[model samples]
Target: MTDFDATAYLPDDLLERIRSRAAAVDAENRFPTEDLAELTAAGYLSILVPTALGGAGLGLAEAAVLQQRLAGAAPATALAINMHLVWTGVAKVMSDRGIDDLRFVQTGAVAGEVFAFGISEAGNDLVLFGSDTQAVPAADGSYSFTGTKIFTSLGPVWTQLGLHGLDTTDPADPKMVYAFVQRTDAVETRDDWDTVGMRGTQSRTTVLNGAVAPADRVVRRVAPGPNPDPIVFGIFSVFEVLLASVYTGVARRALDLAVAAAKTRTSKKTGRPYSDDPDIRWRVAEMALAYDGLLPQVAAIAHDVDVLVDHGGQWFPRLSGLKHRAVVAAKQIVDDAMLVAGGSSYFQRNELSRLYRDVLAGMFHPSDPESAHATVAAAWLGPVGG
Candidate 1:
């Protein structure tokens, strides 16, 4: 626990401030600009970058703990910031294993440059395996990316976007280019992020009209589809674990609120606090059981990633499974908490109601329930009909 103290990174005062603003941010459907500014000034953005590069020099496990704490206060802020952290985490993972390819990413983060993940597309279910975006090579070795990206978190504030595209012009090699493009006139950010939950994220659609990534900035050109490239592992590991951390934090908060309500709210039937009601106590206990189960699993997987413990081909299944369970558990915990809190939590102004909506967003993230089950099944049963 000493290695990863959530409070050490996000103290009470900062969390309270973030929590106080969560409602307004969600109600307005605006980005938590103040939250990001405070976090950046506090060096939260560079948690995964090495100390040599002026960062906190932390690892994925520590980042996970911090992310959980952040989410407890502001799920939208935490989720939006996750896109930036994912790049820095990948840089840390690669650097630890002697790959300096992502050194620039670490340095950029330390310099206060925000990097957003732009891999998710409209219908690209292949995830990182392939890309519908076009990567056309230029005379100077740079590539111009032309395509539309969806759910691009940090879209408005990101100075750099980490994305992937297919370079089919070279029919022989057909490489999938993974690179980062700085914000430019060519990159268009649409004002269309009005969602039911996590409204503060402002995750808008981005149209890349030949957005350019200079030659030196282009990181990888591996063949498309499932490959053993370190970059892929780094991305998948960091993304899934950090994403899970956010929802787990949400569950923790929901459980805390339910317990508090049980102690304060009186039961009409017995004229005693709801805490004295057997049904209320049982529901809270169920929430605690589920919430407690997720913490250790998230910590263990994140620690394994930090220590470079190779799970081989099983890594995807494990990562996806953890994410899937965390989301499902968080959703269930929130639902139970709503019942425990009774009709009071049904109000739009109530924090639990906000959390209930935010937790629903977990289902839409990558390695979703359907995909996670397919992955775990494939790991045990092999390919379908093989």
Candidate 2:
């Protein structure tokens, strides 16, 4: 708990306010505007920016801790904010490695600019390596992205979108263009974000009809597939760790709720609290064991990223594995908590019910189970055909 203390960055009163709004945000399928305001005012959005740039100047280790705490109170709000943090975190990574390419991202974040991640596309299994969206290079070295990006969190309020697309106009030297586009008339947001859980995120579909990212905003132009580029490493490391932190927070809340329920609810036949029941005690213990294992793994990986521990090629596998474990464990913990709470938790209004839906969204994020397994297997046993 000491390692994950969120109060050091976020006050108890702020968390209470966020927690109080969770039910409403989820129920109404509305964005947590107030939560965003408070978090912004408290400088939560700039946690990863450098202190020299007027930010909290914290590393991924501290950011992970705060993310877990924030999600425990409001999962959707945290998830929405995660998109913004990803850009700043990536900027931090680049800066640490002597690359000043993303300093604009860091400065913009501190200036109250919300950066939405718009990399996810429909039927694009290649993830970071390839993009279905097209990045057509223009006369002035700028690029116009024209394709559909799905699951764009902060869709309603983002000032800029950090996205990537395939540039194949020059077939001889096709590249993946990574860039940021400011909100403009060319960008269209489709109001189609209703989902089973994490509803407050309002992660709608974004259709880019030649949305332009000026030459200066153009960040990288690497090959379509994997390379040792610092930007690639920065995106993967920060995204996976922060994502894992959010779901881990969800698991922690579920475990705590289960324990409270077990201690308060009495069994009719035994005329005693369910806490006295051996079966209930065992279930709670199981939940605790799963949650306890994830916390240290999250902390360790985040710490490694902070200290620049060179795991070499093993970094992706380690990062993906940690995310996979945290998400899977969180889902399992929520399922157990629902059972411990009995039929009351089956209600739509129940917090456990909301968590059940929210946790499921974890499976859909990047570094998914299949990809994580593939990455780890490749790391240990070599490529599938090799």
Candidate 3:
């Protein structure tokens, strides 16, 4: 990945266009449809798929770098694409390990099919290990999933919805079903994505009323609760790293804006530019120092994933900890950045105002602060009560 050019796919001109539309998209609270079309045309969605399959033939490390670049320009657009990349990334992870369960996802990316992540439920804290949705098995080995999924990004334009549900008909050995449901009448996307920031994502709630996945699309059926499934690993690794990349990018943008503001805004009390003031300098430096470690950490973990490093049981801890640190560091950077930018940043037109709202969404993604601490603590000091 050292030789990789992240901006090659994104390009400066393309990102400038995407960046230009971000504020309007946010103001209108609509999905970045034009941005998606432009990226789709650029083959940005297929970067992680193998080149033989008509993709850019990149790995997760390169993807992490590219996402950071894209997110810095337009966070909502990058986040909207993250859902699709998660599926393609999982496909790559499986194919890399000789598991072809999700190879179709890679090919689908090349074919311009959009994949939406639908694993999140309203109250399911067990995440990948358990499901509240019902997956009824049919005689043909297909499943009809009936449940509600919340926070489904790319709600308006996804071609496929990848989700999981529980099949409880078997009293003794029920399984968690992982499958992809095509867009159909059974899948209803509610138009309820109004938010303070990242409005362009339009991550709405989806209700599945007997949404069916054919036998071929039913990729996995694993025993629920802490099973060592490869899909689980793939999802956790790719999702956490990419999620961190977007937030880290936002932090980088905030830091840049802070530096720009400090160099221009003169302090009346000191009769000099804020950048020359010791306190402002300290705050900006603190923001930079905190932000600096995030990219390297993201790149290191993503590289380890790409290279298939053997982290063993510690993988969960490492992935969750990395995400936690990145998000917390990002929030801190944005807060300090707003202060450094002075009062002008409080206006809606200011980029910092939008970024401040967008960065808050990072705290709600999977491996949340509480869960991350619990995960790391359990790894170092055994779970409570042995």
lDDT of 2 by residue, 1-386 (tens): 35555686789999999999999999999899999999999999998998999998899989998999999999999999999999999999989989998989999999999999999999998989999999999999999999999999998999999999999988998999999999899999999988999999999999999999999899999998887898899999999999999999999999998999899999999999999999999999999999999989999998898888999999999999999999999999999999999999999988999999999999999998999999999999999889
Clashing pairs in 2: none
lDDT of 1 at 271: 94
lDDT of 1 at 11: 86
Candidate 1: tens digits of C-alpha lDDT, residues 291-369: 9999999999999999889899999999999999999999999999999998999999889999999999999999988
Taking the tens digit of each residue's C-alpha lDDT, what string does model 3 give over 11-57?
99999999999999999999999999999999999999999999999
Clashes in predicted model 2: 0
Every model: Cα RMSD to truth: 0.9, 1.2, 0.7
- Model 2: weakest 10-residue lDDT segment is 1-10
User: Least accurate stretch of 10 residues (summed lDDT) in model 3?
Assistant: 1-10
Off by over 4 Å in 2: 1-5
lDDT of 2 at 179: 99
Candidate 3: residue 52 lDDT (0-100): 91
Model 1 is weakest, by summed lDDT over 10 consecutive residues, at 1-10
Q: Residue 299 of candidate 2: its Cα lDDT?
A: 90
